[model samples]
Target: MNREAGMILISTMLMLALLALLVVSQMQTVFLVYKSLNRLVDKHQSFYQLEMIAQKLSSFNNNQLQAACLVTEKNPDEVFTLLKNGKACSLSYEQQSFFYLIEELGFFPCMQTVKEKGIYSTQHWRLTVLAKDERFNFLQLRIARIAPFIRCEKKPLVFIHTGIISWRYLVR
Candidate 1:
């Protein structure tokens, strides 16, 4: 009887030890999952913020964008620099900050008659948007496709001879 009682106690202790280890392992897994979810949420928030900034920047007339293109530096990282005319291109939405560059990709000849509405050659531009938030930093830089504009005049109207080619998101 004594031997049987001793064996049962040892078995019970081993079982309890295994249960404790399992509980600990489960706890570690739960913590890891929680951290990953938190990071995902932050990234989601930042993505939307960047999109909003890009839209706002792209929603401007060519003259406005041209004026805002004060920073002539081709490097995107140089956007953070304090420039003599940087404020023209800088934007603040809610709690986020943004900077955009309007680079003239190239120009193509228009097929339309040069007489109708004075339609001339078309120009392509790239609007590169950079956003930062004190609360949620941007996950990636957004490139907004403004349009391939058929220049109507030197004033550079936004929609007189323009159409949205496409708006695709680039992530990296």
Candidate 2:
């Protein structure tokens, strides 16, 4: 009887130890899952903010000489002023809000000037956008151009003109 009681006590202790280990592992898994989910949420928020900033930048006219001039100044300290839907505005990104800036601007030509002598002055705009959140960061660069201008002759000539206007982004 004494031997049986001792064996039972030892078995009970072993079972309790196993249960504690299982519980600890489960808790660790739960914690890791929660951390991953939080990171995902932060990434999603950053993407949303970046998309918003891109849309806002896209709405501006690429042909606007004034805006292009502002870009040429290349002043990191100067905030480019823009008018959207008749309202004056500027872009900013913040942790609680969204933060954005124009990183680069340049001209992209569609065709070789030597080959197409007067076909088009230039052909594409390159815009680089950077987006960031607590967990992740994204860089999106896009080339944009005006609709092709068609010239009818013995052969139709198409000319597309574009210039780098602005790059925008948001960070949190």
Candidate 3:
């Protein structure tokens, strides 16, 4: 009877040990999941903030936008200074800062004015945005926009040609 009792006690302890290990592994998995989910949320928030900044940049006047941009080749591979106005946005994390750089890729010549009403031209612009945070999380966004502008002779009226505008957004 005593031998049988000892065997039963050992078996129970072994089962408990295995159960404990399984529980610990499950807890670790849950923690990992939580961490990944948190990172995903942060990335999503960063993307949306960049989108808002892009919209703001697109709405700026041509001259103001030109003044704020750096002219670059269509295939820029070097680093350049960002204009001071790039840091004017209010959307940022506590330990993070957001900056943007605009590059005017090309401006095609305006079509010859036949009518007295107006002349039209198309401009190609690229906007690049970067967000850096304390956690070493970095986000970059690139937007390519083709803006058509119309100028009138009578009143010096300038209008953005909304009908032919094209925009492309990319995130990295």
Judging by TM-score against the true structure, name the best candidate.
Answer: 3
Candidate 2 C-alpha lDDT tens digits along 1-172: 9999999999999999999999999999999999999988977776777666666664455455344222332343233222111112234666433323333344333332223344433344333234422332433334444434433445444333333333434332
lDDT of 1 by residue, 1-172 (tens): 9999999999999999999999999999999999999989987777777777766655656665456563343553443332222443666778666665665555544322233455445545556665544441322232333233454444534332343344554443
TM per candidate: 0.62, 0.55, 0.63
How many residue pairs clash in each candidate at the backbone level?
A: 0, 6, 0
Full candidate order by lDDT, most accurate first: 1, 3, 2
Report per-prediction Cα RMSD to one decimal. 7.0, 8.4, 7.6
Error of 1 at 172 (Å): 6.3
Q: For model 1, what is the alpha-carbon lDDT of residue 48?
A: 79
Which pairs of residues collide in candidate 2? 93-98, 93-99, 93-100, 94-98, 94-99, 100-169
User: lDDT of each prediction vs. the true structure?
Assistant: 0.55, 0.46, 0.53
